[model samples]
Target: MGEWSPDTELDGYEQLVFLLPEEPTYALEPENSLVATLVRHDAPRYPSALLYLHGWKDYFFQTHLADEIDGPGYDFYALDLAATAARCGLSSSPATSRT
Candidate 1:
């Protein structure tokens, strides 16, 4: 993990929570609900980001990354897709599938 200097400010992550219904004639649908968190930072210019993939039996719940993300020019986001059951693995639901 790299350091996030000392100028980062606003940092957070957006999580998809729900899905929207599509017309029957359509071929695909989208999500409808999501939850995001306004990360806590003590900097003022975080401009970079780092996203991590969650392995089996793991979920996102760390704040230290925020400490690094909240820097002068960098922002970081750690995601535990598999563990969260939101998106991961070989599922085609899109709700928990990644290629």
Candidate 2:
């Protein structure tokens, strides 16, 4: 993990990627390896934080949900779990295939 960098998927935000060790996922995950993303505002304004996590075969792209929810004194963030492995060639298996 390193400094937050601009997220290619969405504007007005930054992201950090963590390369996790390979593990058994059965059908839901890829055996080649895994990755996770932590996305946050380039400059967080609130002390209170809110984190959103996307499910399998999904990545965080919606920013309005964060804008709307962060109004309640919360700094919004999102976690994308192994959602980009296949796209980036980190995993050889299909990211969306359950079987």
Candidate 3:
């Protein structure tokens, strides 16, 4: 499905998932990955959008959340942000020092 605008009004439970990578941390290239999911009911005339942010260690695998929001024409969205090594329990990339 095509991307929906945030301003658009949604009708029922229908959404889209999107994976986004961190900009600053991308250069570091951590072992773990971060992803984001955006969901919303899309309609030609009226489209509604919902955006949710999840921690790096946390993910939007909860189907119940979707079921709760699921209705005749409502939509839901979830997002996961890249977390630091501290949160992800991984080795932090050391920055290079230039003389």
| Top TM-score prediction, candidate number | 2
Task: Put down candidate 1 lDDT per residue, 23-88, tens digits, no spaces.
Answer: 121223234322121222333345566655553443444666666555545665544333233233
Per-residue C-alpha lDDT of model 2 across residues 1-99, encoded as one tens digit per residue: 556778757788887766655544546554544656777877788878988876355567678888887778788888876644444443223322212
Candidate 1 structure, TM-score to reference: 0.36
Candidate 3 has what TM-score?
A: 0.42
Query: Which one wins by TM-score: 1 or 2?
Result: 2
lDDT of 3 by residue, 1-99 (tens): 235444212345343433233434445455333323343333432255445566455434565665566553345565434343223632122211000
| Greater-TM-score candidate between 2 and 3 | 2
Report every candidate's CA lDDT.
Answer: 0.36, 0.65, 0.39
Worst 10-residue lDDT window, candidate 1: 17-26
Error of 3 at 90 (Å): 11
TM-score of each predicted structure versus truth: 0.36, 0.69, 0.42
Relative to the unseen true structure, what is the Cα RMSD of model 1?
10.9
Query: Which is the winner by lDDT between candidate 1 and candidate 2?
Result: 2
Whole-model lDDT for model 1 versus the true structure? 0.36
> RMSD in angstroms, all models?
10.9, 5.8, 11.1
